[model samples]
Target: MAMHTLIKEKGISGINVHDWTVLSHKTSILNSQEIDNATNELGIPIPEMIFGNNFLSIEHKSGFKLEFKALPALAMVDQSSKSSDLIKVSYAREWFEKRSMANQEHITDVVKPYDWTYSTKYNGTNLSTDKSLVFSPTTSESIDIEQLKKPDPILFYDENILFEDELADNGTAVLTTKVRVMPSCFFILLRFFLRVDDVLFRIYDTRIYHRFGTNTVIRECSTRESSYRETRSRIPRSKGGDLSLLLDSNWVSSQLPEKESQVEVLTLSQA
Candidate 1:
């Protein structure tokens, strides 16, 4: 599918709007010779014996938008009966309503859009948290791949989230690499139900774009849009390698929220 369809041409509204998903692919174990062939195909100098090494190549994509909207609540009256819970109802409604009405003036000035891009060689380990740890070029070094260690669960890769905005400047692009072990495998010899023989390498990219006219006072909107494209490449194992690995190269759409509905942006008012 096209990014425009997933994100929509008009765009959505809200302080935070983005789409994230994981793509899985079929894989095969590569020998030294095979690794060289695949490396040449990729056109980039990848680690030798790609499967033997602990680190796996990765690519991840994340995109979102921030939209500010005006919300007006006119003439709100308390209609609750004289019950214990009724006392706070009026106050609560008035507080939120008034706050929403006040935010209409400076929403644009306060919310600025951002993007992130950071990349480096990453160590793959089975840690408690699924968070990415980035290493600068100066500190990039290979570690003993626990994936190659015997018996004790070979964690080929770990799932992680990179909190770039939490620790960097606006419009910064964060790029990171990580790998995960896929349960499926194809053995050239035995061809039995195997473990982490096949793995998927990914590169994730997240970006935030501001919608036009949102910086103005008269406009109000908030929504999320997403689009995805995937390609499946079948790799040669031992024999029967002549068979095509290409499954399908197509984009798919998601069933998110409806397009016509309106979303409200809520915030606390100091006044």
Candidate 2:
């Protein structure tokens, strides 16, 4: 199936949005295990894995705009040292609605209609009652083309990690990558999904900054978009691997087409 169609199908399907914020000191190390544990406890699936250019940093900041095709259950597990009384949770749905209305008005006010970016900033405390954490939007004011320049403290990539893999008769081919996200990135994406039905699509334009201070933008979006015509033809068996999660010899068998008639076995194996 075409990638575009697949995306549309997933978006049109019932997908839920769950926004999250993590709190940590600037110098603290982000424990991947802790994050995994939290998500696991909530029964939310952890991302398959993380991939990026620089994995190590002192002040690591990242965010995600996820479009889940189905509304997964959400649960919050607090691991902070502070007492629960100190933690406050605030829903920004009203704030988001107001900002969106203003943006629409602003668009109509412009003489020459061009895309304008807006951002908000919220402290972690705004997110919780304890005032321990806040999130703010990063926005740019309306400036003429000549005055336009990338904002300082610019983020070259979005915090969301994309996972892509193809299951084949024998094995699967997987690829993981990160993309740059714009300010108001999360909210804008969330609104889009809320307004649309059955089809959710996102474009992440790749931007590269060379050591010489040169910047390049790659417009081809979607890390999952790939040419599989040739690769698909080369797969050996249409029904090869076992589906069993166990490693023992007892395997589940399933039927396949005549030409590809083979017993599908489930086996415990590592990816």
Candidate 3:
């Protein structure tokens, strides 16, 4: 897979800032050739649905940039090992054995050192042409959930999946990125949601918020997890509850039992 040589055609949509542009692109899922190319390059089965051509980026006039793309994100996945993020699902072996015999072509059989869950802790990527522009840890400011809930007029909004898989009907692992632009600011959420039928529920989220007329961006990342039974027992059978709600990433994200968060801030002029 000579991934660097592959060409993809896409059109971008963007919002202009004084010195930079907030841009995003959406494109169709990869084709057979592209899938094989990616799989061979990554040394693992490509995801069931991979939008290799889709991306979101902040491009600056001075060539400073930060971008998110599928391949680089997946590159962060822990290649399964004794010390790695190994498969925690006990029945994973049985599922893989059964899947290998059914002529399933969408995914290839996993060799050793593979994380079947494909849980990636990706927090986006930096493609900054300038080396000095970087996000620095901060304790003074954070993303404002209340401000974002004010019902401001939305100028642009979009959500796209980086990749997803159904774990042979046992559960699901999906990574999705969403962005919303309002009259005053724009917010971005990149989430990885994983559910193992009877084992656990995990959510890793990244929130990036920038209020217009400011040179600073606030990014907060959090991780939440709960045992399957514990998560199920919390359901109250209302709009925000139900056994089926377990499958809803948004719903489950709200119900998770624990959270650990980290915050960082970046100024438009990092130098």
Candidate 4:
């Protein structure tokens, strides 16, 4: 397949932070037996065995292409955190000042090295080496309000409901107000810090939604109904864990569908 470039669009605003530790080349934790133990415990399956020189060719339906190198012994922390007041202000200033520069640079178009992995459903299960990261730059040709959907409650109230007509007409009217629940949205950016033994690596991911988009709004929409529904939690570790390091079938499955369907049919027939 022809290699495609990944572009990250500019003027996209968000916040995230992370720290990571990289493992040394001679780390014992990376031994075959140790990796196998982790995979077995996690119930992960190995799908395609890749060599050191193989490049994962990623193509987006939107006509973008990505090629990246997968590195070993890297750690990543992908999370969102509150930024310092001064840092926030400086970021805003930098954003405005570099808006044009960002547009021209089109960071999304650059293809960087990404560590890739697959989820158990796809029959691949390794933790450290199984996790993959891809840096694709995206462009926003138009404002995507849908991207800003958030899960929060919004309240609106009236300011002038309690004052009499005489008092309201004579001076500034005093009004009573109540909270009105509405939909709201917000965006979150995650910075993954990978820790492999003693070495660290960093990767970034962004989750975005509307400023006033709320869970209520998501529930009301048929398209977002599934999001409101609950499901079994798969996270094994809640603290000090690298979610990005976990296998992601969605990423791999998205890439090689033609072969996957054939394999699925065969498995179903045997079952």
Candidate 5:
């Protein structure tokens, strides 16, 4: 691993390693200009915190590539007004009608008709060719939960939030990515968690695992969700945690039901 102290890019720090397989991660807070550019390009109002300049990508000499970027991730957000999955906040109807009747200058709290919560199902973008692909309907080669439980030393570990919003104080919508490199393998998790207070909790997860010196990469993707009340019922009545637990995405995600899950494999050329 090398530092940006030797070679930097536009006030951004990057971790760079050169080999047959290269890993690069760059993150920097965007300025007002950059935020405006992102907003214009995306054609949507930007979130409260959009890391427009952040990205995590891998490139192999053998035409295998994958990347997680803020722009593409934000593009996956459901901005449709007619979408069935729109969060049903109690004040949604009143907020919509008021925004339509009131002058743009007079509008204070609410802004647009889009999914203010900014729920997204994006995992990551795989730029590999057709030759390096496989399909799996089972979890035979999925991310080994037990393996991750081992106390192996993590060589490289980093996490970053691509975007986040407070949902106008209703709840939170955030997307984050975590990467850990161990002795034998590397693992990546892209997570999108959404919570609407007293409404529902939703989580989308993407897990990728690749062992060193192997050409195979296993990816498991899943979505889980449950209503706020249902999630609350899971708490034990005798020793129940407080409502604060519901504010935690990690806790809420575990309490939800799995709606969909799939596993796939990508076969890359030996590095």
Candidate 6:
């Protein structure tokens, strides 16, 4: 229930981007009503496997905590778009088991999440004049801990769209895209976005968090970080719809789990 402090161990500390805590020791089942509601809101079907009792819950310090219930939507996109540029990334339990056979092999070797063409505009005028706007597996450069914290060099490819929502009091919503891949602890990657309020005051998020192990297990444990950039103009309506831009966000890779923390003690239930 306690959160670890944001230490300056890496020499990149100004604004704390993320802090995480493991909130679930076991999974819980979901009723039909919960599934139905989520489906209606997301415009996608919720998977049955997500209701399994064996689940993991995590809380982000500055961001949103991604639970098991949010995985399916975040991991797979609705196949409505016929554009070939849009790609979907999927994973299975076997992917994690095989990775145990080797060390130094990374998940990115096989799958790179958040592959898309990016374009930025201000008042309908393109702003990304210096660099290539496309971001994908082939174009993505390998990132380290330092790169994850800073806002420059533009590591990951992201996109944002604004829409009108009658249910929203502000009448407008913005969705900003992001993706992450973790092969070492959990063999999973998720490409999802956050629906922020008109003025960027509130956030509704969905993310992918994978679970592994049969008898005894230690799930993937790591911290995530991100930086943001605000719009220069005061009149968002005249300039552009978005109020803030996600400079970059990613998991901390340099840190490792403690030996004691990696082991678990469990009690079995009699059938």
Which ten contiguous residues of candidate 2 have the minimum total lDDT?
190-199
Model 3, 10-82: lDDT tens per residue? 5667666445567778888999999999998898776788999888876666566777788887887777563
Which residue runs of candidate 4 sit more than 4 Å off their true CA positions? 1-138, 141-184, 213-271
Q: Top lDDT: which candidate number?
A: 3
lDDT of each: 0.22, 0.20, 0.75, 0.22, 0.70, 0.27
Mark the 10 consecutive residues where model 3 has the least summed lDDT: 1-10
What is the C-alpha lDDT profile of model 2 across 179-254, one tens digit per residue? 2222222111111000001111111222111111111111111111111222223334653543231111111001
TM-score of 1: 0.17
Q: Can you tell me which runs of candidate 6 are displaced by over 4 Å?
A: 1-20, 52-76, 79-271
Predicted candidate 5 versus true structure: per-residue lDDT over 61-159, tens digit per residue: 667777787789878766675442344454455344544564433323443546666777777877766554543566567777787888987666677
lDDT of 5 at 129: 66
Task: State, as a TM-score between 0 and 1, how close model 2 is to the true structure.
Answer: 0.19
**Cα lDDT tens digits for candidate 1, 56-152:** 1121122111211000000011112322132123234433443366564332222222101112212222121223322222222222234224243
Global CA lDDT computed for model 3: 0.75
Per TM-score, the best of the predicted structures is 3
Candidate 1 deviates by what RMSD? Answer: 27.8
| Candidate 3 off by > 4 Å | 1-11, 17-19, 83-112, 238-242
Candidate 1's C-alpha runs over 4 A off are 1-104, 108-157, 164-179, 183-271
